[model samples]
Target chain A: MIQVEHLTKKFGRIVAVDDISFRIKKGEIIGFLGPNGAGKSTTMNILTGCISASEGKALINGIDILEEPAKVKKMIGYLPENPPLYGEMTAKEFLHTVCDLKNIPKPVRKDEINRVMKRVGIVDVSGRLIRNLSKGYKQRVGLAQAMIGKPPIMILDEPTVGLDPGQIIGIRNLINDLGRDHTVILSSHILSEVQAVCERVMIIAKGKIIASDTPENLSQHLFGSNRLFVSVAAETAAVEKTVKSIPDIIEYQIEEGEEIGAVSVKMKAAENTDIRKAVFSAFAAANQPLLMMRPIDMSLEEIFLDLTSAEVEL
Target chain B: MIAVYKKELKSYFYTPGAYIFMGAFLLIAGLLFSLQNVFAGDSNYAGFLSSLIFIFLLVVPILTMKLFTEEKRQKTDILLLSSPVSIIGIVLGKYLAAVTVFAATLLITMLYPLFLSFHGRMDWAQIWGTYIGFFFLGSAFIAIGTFLSEVAESQTSAAILTFCGLLASWIIDYIISFVPTSSMAGAIFILILAGAAIAVFQSKAQDWRISAAAAVIAIAAVCILYIVTPDMLYGLISKFIAWFSLTSRFQRFSMGILKLDAVIYYLSFSAFFLYVTGSRIENRRWS
Candidate 1:
């Protein structure tokens, strides 16, 4: 339900978001993957109407944000990088304030806030001052603030940055649950969090969208050759010799296996080649038992590094 | 807007700012009341009301220092900006909240006059008029503090800057007395004033051509004024100072003379500063 066209943001001489364009459909959970200073926050800030873009425009449900910010802002809930919280106020009071800002009716504000607090699991700390809460609770409070009005879209920047591992999982599952009805857009440094929670991934670098696709497609399409890790019940030298005999195996690294009297070899095969059968046969001929073999797929972390740093062509 | 107003008003109480301001204000007002009316047996409350402007100058910064600077330092401005509330709503909401605190404190001090009414006859009309003037004057100072709070980076600096700004206003008449009132000096002063105004407009518009045109037109207008009525140019600096002199207008209010123009002057002065504060906030998003 959000469309951005050639949006660019400049802070004096530095370009934060440079002519990047993307669209997010309704009920789609999109994850922004990038390193620090990748303009992810800037893009989110522009879309949320917190800051104006230097060029182009963003439309929420076909309404220009700059032209009608109040109407557009009503449809989007934003959680900034730092949770915009008043530490002196209690969590419940903070949510009530957010409801008021969003123009939620007074009678239903309490119920709405309680529902969100329950959803984000911050109900117990709702009465405690936000400043006294731990970081995890504060983050949940931030998330609860975004979910109070149940707006159609939620734009969260680095939602799981400082939370513990368990809390991170809870927030990830919460985002996944939220994606059932809400269009979820979150940015995080944790690759696995995005991979687990997002339906699609957009890799941005230096204010440019380098790649956008599903998690599986990104790993499969960006990876040129097949890589296999095989364990053979033989010495390292014999495993290396067998690996050399197979011309399909372009590169190989042999190391000792965890299994006694065995060697594990990681090998890269030619494009689309199935070295599993060849390795099985070669090891069988040598009277060496083939213990295990499996193809290795590139992880999202590698793809991100490749796209962001190496600037790999799609 | 109501939400922001309620939150800001409640926050003032939640922190020590409101209490400190009110405590300090009431302490001084009480001391002055006891010393001037009780000890001196003075029936003149106008003098007492006139001296209360000093209280506003001392404590207005406390009431306004955190209006925006704290929001910014805490990064809570994001919540306000990203919400459906307009910038004008937020500014007015905060502005009115500060004014409300100042008004409530003023109301508490009404006991001073009520005690005076117990003993003998009092000029109720003049006393009420002075109260109105004091409210407006304090409001004008609060507006100035609100604008400076947004301009400063931190609360301490905002408070210090606001205090200095109000101090400058207090001494504006004295400064005007020292300035040369010759026609040549007035012409040059008007030219400098025009230049400063054009410079502010240039910074906001960021167009050299428009700014240059404005500067030329303003210079040409001043030159024409200088040639046409050199006599009018004399003492022009004092006139300009009088136009902006906030305390000078207060003298009329304290003298039991309720001038409509002075009331409008105080109101317009507050509105002008508040409008500039709103523009400064809107410009923040672009920057």
Candidate 2:
């Protein structure tokens, strides 16, 4: 649904998005993972036609944004980090205005507004002025505004940021439901949210797309899949001796156990090694009960933090 | 475009901006109307409109202060900018909405002349000609106010800047009276104008090559003109100021001399300012 080619955006001397390129297919839910100032919002703004890129071009379904912005904008809905809302307007009025902006037929505008309000669950507060609405309601209203015309693509920047945990779940579910028909590109620092809702993740740092892959593949690729965590009810010294004796053991850490006289340990085996059997037998031979043994995969948060901080070759 | 117009118009009414502008305008107009025409038994309705011309100077900024600034500060411009609507549509929509409020207020004030008609004879052509002039003049001011609002970052600063801009227009004729009429002074002033233009272009484009090219071209054009016909530079500053002076041109309409050029002047002035406003916004995305 979107193709960005060598896109770069410069604000005076500062490069906000530099030489970044990516493509998103139809019906794909992609998460943009980055820390603050990671060119995520800049990329979203360029795709939505809110701002023009300083160099290169972006295509929305083969439509050039700078050449035919109005036509392209009609196909994409954007929810900026700060919801673009008028405090004087009610939620219904705001949505109606958005429908007009999107050029929906007058006959269908009423139904479209109502359906979107229902979808975003803002129908009940449609009559209340936006100034009186709470942050969660306001966010929903912003979402409703973007969904009013049923654009094929939705670019939501931190869509679930200010919502309570329950509300976050609700919106996450909404985005998942929306993924059936809409191409979703959402940017957030919340790694778990992205992991839960997105099929693919693009990690951006310092204005570059440093990595792009499925979350699981990223973990497997970045850190080889042989790392494991094991806890045993035994003396720390004995656990260390057994860990040293275990073959294919690359690196390991001995950690304090929750129970007295037991030790918790984490270890990384050699490439492609299934250290589980070796770890089990090693602990059994020492007469130490193996309380837990599981391979430890990298979570999205660690991958995001580590990738943004240092260079990682794919 | 209609959506933007309706929203902006409704906002003016919902906020106290339209009411305050119209209230102050009509109150002063009413006081002036009753005192001059009713009490003094004057019959010149055009005189009343001409005398009330000062109302637009104070009230136009109130009508236009938040037109673009509010959308920007609230970040609601993202909706408008990201939508399918064109920048011209948004600018014209907001401009027309502000004009509509001023027109509606002017229509109410028309009842004053109708009241005078009940008592005695009135020069209907002169009355309406002045009304047309006042409408165009107020529209021109609204356009300036709109441009200033776009330049300012907040509503308060927009209003203050617009007020100062309009007030400067009110005193432009006096300011021009003191400008030097010598060719040297005019050439110097033109050079300064070119320098300012180059400065603005340099800051926006951030490209020394383009700005330097523009500066070279500007200087060359001025030098050629100076060498070709130096007389053309004499009193050039006053002519430039006079060409841009909205109120001085409005004097022709107030005199009941409906010159085609003056009407076109008022319209073109408003169009020019509005075009600047549109460019200011359109350039925002690129920059």
Candidate 3:
């Protein structure tokens, strides 16, 4: 339930958020993928009403941010990159303060705070000062703060940036769970996290949205070559020559191994080609035993790099 | 707004800022009351109250330094700004919180006056009137400190800038004496002030025509005023400086003469600063 139209933010001479636009439907889990300084945070700030845009406008449920920020802000729960925490305050106190600022009814404030704390798994540390908690716990508290108001939209910027692997997974699961009812727009440089958690991905670079699609489609669209890694009992030169003879084999690299008579060859085939059959037959005709052959699916990391780097021919 | 106000008030006590501000203020008031009234055996509580203005130079910063600077440094402002709370709510909450601490501390020092009432004759009406003026004056200073804190980037800078700002206001009466009283100097000063306003407008709107027209209008107004009312420009610079001299207005309170204009002036002064602080915060979101 968000609409952004040609939003731009400028800091003095530098345009932090270039002419960018996007929309999120209700209950959609959207991932904002971009390298550092990609204007992801700027866009999030604009959407959350934390900051204003130099041009264009953002609407939360058709409430223009510039015209009626307080109303729109009530619908958004923003967890900034730094968490916006008061380290001196205990978790419970912090959440209570957030509830108050959100104008939650006094009757339900305590229950709402507890519910969010339980959701983010921070109930145990509610009595501890936020400064005494670890980074992961602090992040959970930040999440708890955002979820306290039960707002329909949650904008989290790098929610799991410094967390350990287990904590990251926990947060990802929490986000996925939250996505069932609330619209989520999360930004992270961690490609796999976004790929695993987000339903749709928007890849931004230099303040521009270069690509937007489903995570699977983005990976598949950016990956133009099918790679097949094969370990074969054959001479390196002969294996390379045979693989190069395949009709659609675009490139091949052979790695000589310590094993006296084996070679590992990585072969690249044209997009959508089944090169395994051709390679197997080619090796079979030469009496070279194929030890292993497997197609290498491009990882999200590679696709993210390919999408964000300037050299990518969008 | 109420929520923010409550939370802000609670935070003052939760942190060391309120304690430090109150403790330092009471200590100074105690020392001053003893020295000016008890040691001297003088029954004039107004003199002791008048000397307490110096305490604001130190403790006002403590009360207000963290109002906005700490929020910015901690990034907690994002939560406040992104919430349903208006900028005015946030500013008022912070201002009232600081004022509350100052008021609470001032209340503790009321014991000094009670002790005086026990031992000797006391002018209760004058004492109460002076207190009202002092409260308003302190609120105005805290507002100025709040605005200074918002303009400064770091807490240390905010504290230091607020101290300097309060110091300037403290010495404003003296500084006014050195200002040029000639009509020519006043006209030139007015022109410079008008130019600064036009420059601010140009920076914001980035429209040369509008700023140019504004500049022409300002200069023409100044020229017409100079030609029509030559006597109005005499001592104009001193009058302008005196108008901003917060302490000069505060003197009426210490004299136990609570003038309506002075009370309104102190209130409007505070409102003006609070408005500036709110605008600065809103401008930050756009910039």
Best candidate, lDDT: 1
Give the clashing pairs for model 2. none
Measured with C-alpha atoms, the lDDT of residue B213 in candidate 3 is: 90
lDDT of each residue in A278-314, candidate 2, tens digit only: 8898889989998887888889898888888775444
Q: How do all models score by TM-score?
A: 0.95, 0.94, 0.95
Give a tens-digit lDDT track for model 1, residues B139-230: 89999999999999999999999999999898897888888899988889988998999889888889999999988998888899899998
Relative to the unseen true structure, what is the C-alpha lDDT of residue B21 in candidate 1, on a scale of 0 to 100? 91
Q: Residues B146-170, candidate 2: write the lDDT tens digits.
A: 8998999998999999898888888
**DockQ of every candidate:** 0.83, 0.83, 0.85
Error of 2 at B151 (Å): 1.0
What TM-score does structure 1 among the candidates reach? 0.95
Instruction: Assess candidate 2 and give its TM-score to the true structure.
Output: 0.94
- Global Cα RMSD, each model: 2.3, 2.6, 2.1
Error of 3 at B219 (Å): 5.7
Ranking under lDDT, best-scoring first? 1, 2, 3
Q: Across residues A1-314, which tens digit of lDDT does each residue of candidate 3 receive?
A: 89999998899999888899889999999999888999999999999888889999998898898899888888888899999888889999988888888889999988898789889998789999998999999999999988887889999999999999999999999999999999999999889889999999998888889889998887677674488888989888888777877788778788985567889888888788777788889999988899888877788788778666653565
